[model samples]
Target: MRAPLKLYLAGPDVFLPNAAAQAEAKCRLCAEFGMTGIAPFNPDLDMARPAAQLWQEIYADDLRMMRESDAILANLTPFRGASADAGTLVELGWFLGQGKPVFGYSNSAVSFAARSRAQPDDALPGTAIEDFGLADNLMIEGSLTLPLTLPPDGQCRPFDSLEIFQLCLEGIAGWGQGFNR
Candidate 1:
Protein backbone atom coordinates (compact mmCIF):
# COMPACT_ATOMS: atom_id res chain seq x y z
CA MET A 1 0.00 0.00 0.00
CA ARG A 2 1.15 3.53 -0.66
CA ALA A 3 2.33 5.44 2.37
CA PRO A 4 0.24 8.34 3.59
CA LEU A 5 0.97 11.61 1.86
CA LYS A 6 2.75 14.18 3.97
CA LEU A 7 1.22 17.64 3.56
CA TYR A 8 2.84 20.84 4.74
CA LEU A 9 0.16 23.04 6.30
CA ALA A 10 1.05 26.62 5.50
CA GLY A 11 -0.79 29.54 7.07
CA PRO A 12 -0.81 32.31 9.71
CA ASP A 13 -2.78 30.12 12.08
CA VAL A 14 0.40 29.58 14.05
CA PHE A 15 0.06 33.13 15.31
CA LEU A 16 -3.33 32.49 16.83
CA PRO A 17 -3.66 32.22 20.60
CA ASN A 18 -4.58 28.56 20.35
CA ALA A 19 -1.96 27.66 17.80
CA ALA A 20 -1.08 24.28 19.25
CA ALA A 21 -4.69 23.26 19.54
CA GLN A 22 -5.39 24.41 16.01
CA ALA A 23 -2.48 22.38 14.69
CA GLU A 24 -3.66 19.31 16.55
CA ALA A 25 -7.15 19.65 15.12
CA LYS A 26 -5.79 20.06 11.62
CA CYS A 27 -3.53 17.03 11.99
CA ARG A 28 -6.48 15.00 13.13
CA LEU A 29 -8.44 16.03 10.05
CA CYS A 30 -5.49 15.10 7.85
CA ALA A 31 -5.29 11.65 9.39
CA GLU A 32 -9.00 11.13 8.79
CA PHE A 33 -8.28 11.64 5.12
CA GLY A 34 -5.18 9.46 5.01
CA MET A 35 -2.66 12.27 4.99
CA THR A 36 -0.26 13.71 7.57
CA GLY A 37 -0.36 17.44 8.22
CA ILE A 38 2.91 19.07 9.18
CA ALA A 39 2.03 22.26 10.96
CA PRO A 40 4.68 25.00 11.22
CA PHE A 41 5.43 24.60 14.94
CA ASN A 42 8.37 22.44 16.01
CA PRO A 43 8.18 21.42 19.64
CA ASP A 44 11.80 20.23 19.70
CA LEU A 45 13.29 23.70 19.13
CA ASP A 46 15.22 25.16 22.08
CA MET A 47 13.16 28.08 23.29
CA ALA A 48 15.94 29.32 25.53
CA ARG A 49 18.01 30.43 22.54
CA PRO A 50 18.45 34.08 21.55
CA ALA A 51 15.74 35.70 19.42
CA ALA A 52 17.89 35.75 16.30
CA GLN A 53 18.83 32.11 16.69
CA LEU A 54 15.22 31.16 17.35
CA TRP A 55 14.12 32.83 14.14
CA GLN A 56 16.88 31.13 12.18
CA GLU A 57 16.09 27.77 13.69
CA ILE A 58 12.40 28.12 12.88
CA TYR A 59 13.20 29.14 9.31
CA ALA A 60 15.57 26.22 8.83
CA ASP A 61 13.11 23.77 10.31
CA ASP A 62 10.28 25.04 8.12
CA LEU A 63 12.41 24.70 5.01
CA ARG A 64 13.32 21.17 5.96
CA MET A 65 9.65 20.33 6.50
CA MET A 66 8.74 21.76 3.12
CA ARG A 67 11.42 19.69 1.45
CA GLU A 68 10.18 16.54 3.13
CA SER A 69 6.51 17.16 2.44
CA ASP A 70 4.79 15.60 -0.53
CA ALA A 71 2.57 18.63 -1.12
CA ILE A 72 1.39 21.87 0.48
CA LEU A 73 -2.07 22.91 1.62
CA ALA A 74 -2.00 26.64 2.18
CA ASN A 75 -4.52 28.86 3.92
CA LEU A 76 -4.96 31.76 1.52
CA THR A 77 -7.12 33.69 3.94
CA PRO A 78 -6.21 37.33 4.33
CA PHE A 79 -4.46 38.06 7.60
CA ARG A 80 -3.44 41.38 9.28
CA GLY A 81 -3.83 42.95 5.82
CA ALA A 82 -5.63 42.58 2.54
CA SER A 83 -3.64 39.56 1.44
CA ALA A 84 -2.64 36.17 2.69
CA ASP A 85 0.25 35.98 5.14
CA ALA A 86 3.50 36.81 3.38
CA GLY A 87 5.34 33.88 4.88
CA THR A 88 2.66 31.47 3.73
CA LEU A 89 2.82 32.94 0.25
CA VAL A 90 6.57 32.38 0.14
CA GLU A 91 6.11 28.83 1.34
CA LEU A 92 3.57 28.25 -1.41
CA GLY A 93 6.05 29.51 -3.96
CA TRP A 94 8.70 27.22 -2.60
CA PHE A 95 6.38 24.24 -2.89
CA LEU A 96 5.54 25.19 -6.44
CA GLY A 97 9.22 25.53 -7.24
CA GLN A 98 9.67 21.98 -5.99
CA GLY A 99 6.90 20.85 -8.42
CA LYS A 100 4.67 19.60 -5.64
CA PRO A 101 0.90 19.74 -5.96
CA VAL A 102 -0.33 23.01 -4.48
CA PHE A 103 -3.75 23.45 -2.91
CA GLY A 104 -5.26 26.47 -1.17
CA TYR A 105 -8.38 27.77 0.59
CA SER A 106 -9.57 31.12 1.76
CA ASN A 107 -11.70 31.84 4.77
CA SER A 108 -12.92 34.95 3.02
CA ALA A 109 -15.26 34.58 0.11
CA VAL A 110 -14.47 38.05 -1.24
CA SER A 111 -12.61 38.30 -4.52
CA PHE A 112 -9.06 39.56 -4.56
CA ALA A 113 -10.07 42.72 -6.36
CA ALA A 114 -12.71 43.55 -3.79
CA ARG A 115 -10.30 42.98 -0.98
CA SER A 116 -7.76 45.20 -2.68
CA ARG A 117 -10.31 47.93 -3.04
CA ALA A 118 -11.14 47.67 0.64
CA GLN A 119 -7.55 48.42 1.54
CA PRO A 120 -6.82 52.00 2.61
CA ASP A 121 -6.14 54.37 -0.32
CA ASP A 122 -2.54 54.90 0.72
CA ALA A 123 -1.99 51.20 1.03
CA LEU A 124 -2.41 50.47 -2.68
CA PRO A 125 -2.32 53.72 -4.59
CA GLY A 126 -1.87 53.38 -8.37
CA THR A 127 -2.06 49.62 -8.02
CA ALA A 128 -4.15 47.98 -10.66
CA ILE A 129 -6.44 45.38 -9.16
CA GLU A 130 -6.52 42.23 -11.21
CA ASP A 131 -10.06 40.95 -11.54
CA PHE A 132 -9.74 37.21 -11.89
CA GLY A 133 -12.25 36.59 -9.07
CA LEU A 134 -9.53 34.84 -7.14
CA ALA A 135 -8.96 34.94 -3.40
CA ASP A 136 -5.37 36.16 -3.67
CA ASN A 137 -2.78 37.63 -6.05
CA LEU A 138 -2.89 36.27 -9.59
CA MET A 139 0.61 34.88 -9.35
CA ILE A 140 -0.54 32.68 -6.47
CA GLU A 141 -3.92 31.77 -7.91
CA GLY A 142 -2.70 31.39 -11.46
CA SER A 143 -0.34 28.60 -10.46
CA LEU A 144 -3.22 26.21 -10.04
CA THR A 145 -5.97 25.52 -12.53
CA LEU A 146 -8.29 24.34 -9.80
CA PRO A 147 -10.40 26.90 -7.98
CA LEU A 148 -9.61 27.59 -4.33
CA THR A 149 -11.67 25.69 -1.81
CA LEU A 150 -14.13 28.03 -0.12
CA PRO A 151 -16.84 27.80 2.49
CA PRO A 152 -20.02 26.27 1.13
CA ASP A 153 -22.20 29.20 2.17
CA GLY A 154 -20.00 31.67 0.30
CA GLN A 155 -19.40 33.78 3.38
CA CYS A 156 -16.27 34.64 5.29
CA ARG A 157 -15.30 32.74 8.40
CA PRO A 158 -12.80 33.23 11.19
CA PHE A 159 -9.25 32.28 10.30
CA ASP A 160 -9.30 29.46 12.84
CA SER A 161 -12.64 28.05 11.79
CA LEU A 162 -12.42 24.29 11.45
CA GLU A 163 -15.42 24.26 9.09
CA ILE A 164 -13.56 25.98 6.30
CA PHE A 165 -10.36 24.18 7.11
CA GLN A 166 -12.12 20.88 6.63
CA LEU A 167 -13.37 22.02 3.25
CA CYS A 168 -9.80 22.68 2.24
CA LEU A 169 -8.68 19.34 3.59
CA GLU A 170 -11.39 17.55 1.64
CA GLY A 171 -10.37 19.35 -1.51
CA ILE A 172 -6.71 18.42 -1.04
CA ALA A 173 -7.62 14.85 -0.25
CA GLY A 174 -9.55 14.60 -3.49
CA TRP A 175 -6.73 16.17 -5.41
CA GLY A 176 -4.21 13.77 -3.88
CA GLN A 177 -6.32 10.77 -4.81
CA GLY A 178 -6.60 11.86 -8.43
CA PHE A 179 -2.92 12.73 -8.52
CA ASN A 180 -1.91 9.30 -7.33
CA ARG A 181 -4.02 7.66 -10.01
Candidate 2:
Protein backbone atom coordinates (compact mmCIF):
# COMPACT_ATOMS: atom_id res chain seq x y z
CA MET A 1 0.00 0.00 0.00
CA ARG A 2 1.16 3.53 -0.68
CA ALA A 3 2.19 5.59 2.31
CA PRO A 4 -0.37 8.25 3.15
CA LEU A 5 0.57 11.73 2.07
CA LYS A 6 1.97 13.51 5.12
CA LEU A 7 0.70 17.07 5.39
CA TYR A 8 2.49 19.60 7.59
CA LEU A 9 -0.36 21.89 8.60
CA ALA A 10 0.52 25.46 9.59
CA GLY A 11 -1.52 28.26 11.18
CA PRO A 12 -1.62 30.95 13.90
CA ASP A 13 -1.61 29.85 17.52
CA VAL A 14 -2.56 33.05 19.30
CA PHE A 15 -5.98 31.50 19.63
CA LEU A 16 -4.37 28.50 21.19
CA PRO A 17 -7.48 26.58 22.08
CA ASN A 18 -9.34 27.46 18.93
CA ALA A 19 -6.31 27.12 16.70
CA ALA A 20 -5.52 23.74 18.14
CA ALA A 21 -9.06 22.60 17.62
CA GLN A 22 -9.04 23.74 14.04
CA ALA A 23 -5.76 22.02 13.43
CA GLU A 24 -7.13 18.73 14.69
CA ALA A 25 -10.25 19.08 12.62
CA LYS A 26 -8.18 19.68 9.53
CA CYS A 27 -6.03 16.70 10.34
CA ARG A 28 -9.04 14.47 10.54
CA LEU A 29 -10.36 15.80 7.29
CA CYS A 30 -7.05 15.17 5.61
CA ALA A 31 -7.17 11.61 6.86
CA GLU A 32 -10.59 11.27 5.33
CA PHE A 33 -8.90 12.13 2.06
CA GLY A 34 -6.07 9.66 2.65
CA MET A 35 -3.51 12.07 4.04
CA THR A 36 -1.71 12.20 7.39
CA GLY A 37 -1.65 15.62 9.02
CA ILE A 38 1.09 16.94 11.31
CA ALA A 39 0.75 20.19 13.16
CA PRO A 40 2.91 22.32 15.51
CA PHE A 41 -0.02 22.87 17.82
CA ASN A 42 0.33 19.38 19.25
CA PRO A 43 0.46 19.32 23.03
CA ASP A 44 3.82 17.52 23.07
CA LEU A 45 5.47 20.49 21.40
CA ASP A 46 6.86 23.27 23.62
CA MET A 47 5.16 26.40 22.32
CA ALA A 48 5.12 28.55 25.45
CA ARG A 49 8.74 29.57 25.35
CA PRO A 50 10.12 33.04 24.61
CA ALA A 51 9.45 34.42 21.13
CA ALA A 52 12.96 33.89 19.78
CA GLN A 53 13.31 30.41 21.16
CA LEU A 54 9.80 29.43 20.20
CA TRP A 55 10.48 30.49 16.63
CA GLN A 56 13.71 28.53 16.50
CA GLU A 57 11.97 25.41 17.73
CA ILE A 58 9.03 25.90 15.40
CA TYR A 59 11.34 26.30 12.41
CA ALA A 60 13.23 23.18 13.30
CA ASP A 61 10.11 21.14 13.88
CA ASP A 62 8.33 22.32 10.73
CA LEU A 63 11.44 21.91 8.61
CA ARG A 64 11.70 18.29 9.64
CA MET A 65 8.07 17.68 8.81
CA MET A 66 8.28 19.43 5.46
CA ARG A 67 11.34 17.43 4.55
CA GLU A 68 9.50 14.19 5.14
CA SER A 69 5.98 15.22 4.19
CA ASP A 70 4.33 15.45 0.79
CA ALA A 71 2.87 18.95 1.05
CA ILE A 72 1.51 21.70 3.33
CA LEU A 73 -1.91 23.08 4.29
CA ALA A 74 -1.91 26.47 6.00
CA ASN A 75 -4.65 28.51 7.64
CA LEU A 76 -3.90 31.98 6.41
CA THR A 77 -6.63 33.47 8.59
CA PRO A 78 -5.36 36.50 10.45
CA PHE A 79 -5.56 36.28 14.18
CA ARG A 80 -7.27 39.54 15.25
CA GLY A 81 -6.59 40.90 11.79
CA ALA A 82 -2.87 41.22 12.51
CA SER A 83 -1.95 38.55 9.96
CA ALA A 84 -1.83 34.78 9.77
CA ASP A 85 0.01 33.67 12.88
CA ALA A 86 3.67 34.65 12.51
CA GLY A 87 5.01 31.21 13.28
CA THR A 88 2.67 29.66 10.74
CA LEU A 89 3.95 32.11 8.15
CA VAL A 90 7.47 31.00 8.89
CA GLU A 91 6.46 27.38 8.41
CA LEU A 92 4.77 28.20 5.12
CA GLY A 93 7.91 29.88 3.90
CA TRP A 94 10.02 26.94 4.92
CA PHE A 95 7.84 24.50 2.97
CA LEU A 96 7.75 26.77 -0.06
CA GLY A 97 11.50 27.25 0.11
CA GLN A 98 11.78 23.48 -0.19
CA GLY A 99 9.59 23.59 -3.31
CA LYS A 100 6.77 21.82 -1.56
CA PRO A 101 3.21 22.50 -2.65
CA VAL A 102 1.22 24.75 -0.29
CA PHE A 103 -2.52 25.32 0.19
CA GLY A 104 -3.82 28.05 2.51
CA TYR A 105 -7.21 29.46 3.54
CA SER A 106 -7.90 32.93 4.89
CA ASN A 107 -11.26 33.64 6.53
CA SER A 108 -10.18 37.13 7.43
CA ALA A 109 -12.04 40.27 6.49
CA VAL A 110 -8.94 42.43 6.80
CA SER A 111 -6.10 41.99 4.35
CA PHE A 112 -2.44 42.30 5.35
CA ALA A 113 -2.19 45.67 3.66
CA ALA A 114 -5.31 46.81 5.48
CA ARG A 115 -3.78 45.98 8.83
CA SER A 116 -0.79 48.12 8.05
CA ARG A 117 -3.12 50.91 6.99
CA ALA A 118 -4.97 50.62 10.28
CA GLN A 119 -1.83 51.26 12.27
CA PRO A 120 -1.10 54.88 13.12
CA ASP A 121 1.38 56.18 10.59
CA ASP A 122 3.55 57.50 13.43
CA ALA A 123 3.40 54.26 15.41
CA LEU A 124 6.95 53.30 14.45
CA PRO A 125 9.62 54.73 12.20
CA GLY A 126 10.78 51.45 10.71
CA THR A 127 7.65 49.39 11.13
CA ALA A 128 7.40 47.00 8.20
CA ILE A 129 3.77 46.67 7.22
CA GLU A 130 3.26 42.98 6.77
CA ASP A 131 0.62 42.02 4.26
CA PHE A 132 -1.03 38.63 4.59
CA GLY A 133 -2.23 39.24 1.10
CA LEU A 134 -0.30 36.51 -0.69
CA ALA A 135 2.10 33.65 -0.17
CA ASP A 136 3.66 30.95 -2.32
CA ASN A 137 0.83 28.56 -1.48
CA LEU A 138 -2.66 28.29 -2.94
CA MET A 139 -4.96 30.84 -1.26
CA ILE A 140 -8.39 29.27 -0.79
CA GLU A 141 -10.98 32.04 -0.87
CA GLY A 142 -13.94 29.71 -1.18
CA SER A 143 -16.73 31.63 0.46
CA LEU A 144 -15.17 34.99 -0.18
CA THR A 145 -15.35 34.29 -3.86
CA LEU A 146 -18.89 33.00 -3.83
CA PRO A 147 -20.00 32.00 -7.36
CA LEU A 148 -17.03 33.89 -8.70
CA THR A 149 -13.59 32.38 -8.76
CA LEU A 150 -11.07 34.98 -7.73
CA PRO A 151 -7.46 34.98 -8.72
CA PRO A 152 -4.90 33.46 -6.36
CA ASP A 153 -3.77 36.86 -4.99
CA GLY A 154 -7.21 38.42 -4.66
CA GLN A 155 -9.41 39.34 -1.69
CA CYS A 156 -10.18 37.26 1.41
CA ARG A 157 -12.70 34.41 1.30
CA PRO A 158 -15.05 34.16 4.25
CA PHE A 159 -16.48 30.75 3.29
CA ASP A 160 -13.69 29.14 1.34
CA SER A 161 -12.28 26.78 3.97
CA LEU A 162 -13.83 23.64 2.49
CA GLU A 163 -12.74 24.52 -0.99
CA ILE A 164 -9.29 25.18 0.36
CA PHE A 165 -9.21 21.73 1.85
CA GLN A 166 -10.28 20.10 -1.38
CA LEU A 167 -7.71 22.00 -3.37
CA CYS A 168 -4.98 21.10 -0.94
CA LEU A 169 -5.94 17.46 -1.02
CA GLU A 170 -5.74 17.41 -4.77
CA GLY A 171 -2.50 19.30 -4.76
CA ILE A 172 -1.01 16.95 -2.20
CA ALA A 173 -2.10 13.89 -4.15
CA GLY A 174 -0.45 15.30 -7.24
CA TRP A 175 2.66 16.28 -5.33
CA GLY A 176 2.92 12.84 -3.80
CA GLN A 177 2.69 11.27 -7.23
CA GLY A 178 5.73 13.26 -8.27
CA PHE A 179 7.65 11.70 -5.40
CA ASN A 180 6.85 8.18 -6.63
CA ARG A 181 8.04 9.01 -10.16
- The lDDT for every candidate, in the order shown, is 0.86, 0.60
Q: Give the TM-scores of the predictions, in the order they appear.
A: 0.93, 0.61
- Segments of candidate 2 deviating more than 4 angstroms: 18-20, 45-59, 80-82, 124-181
Root-mean-square deviation of candidate 2: 6.5
- Model 1 clashing residue pairs (backbone): none
Model 1 TM-score on a 0 to 1 scale: 0.93
Model 2 score (lDDT): 0.60
Q: List the residue pairs that clash in candidate 2.
A: 112-132, 142-160, 143-159, 143-160, 144-157
Choose the strongest candidate by TM-score. 1
Over 1-181, each residue of candidate 2 has an lDDT whose tens digit, in order, gives 7888787776664246476666777778888877898866645567688988877785676677778776667766665545556666666666767776666655544555766677567757776655545332223332111221222455556532555555556555655665651
RMSD of 1: 1.6
Specify the poorest-scoring 10-residue window by lDDT in model 1. Answer: 172-181
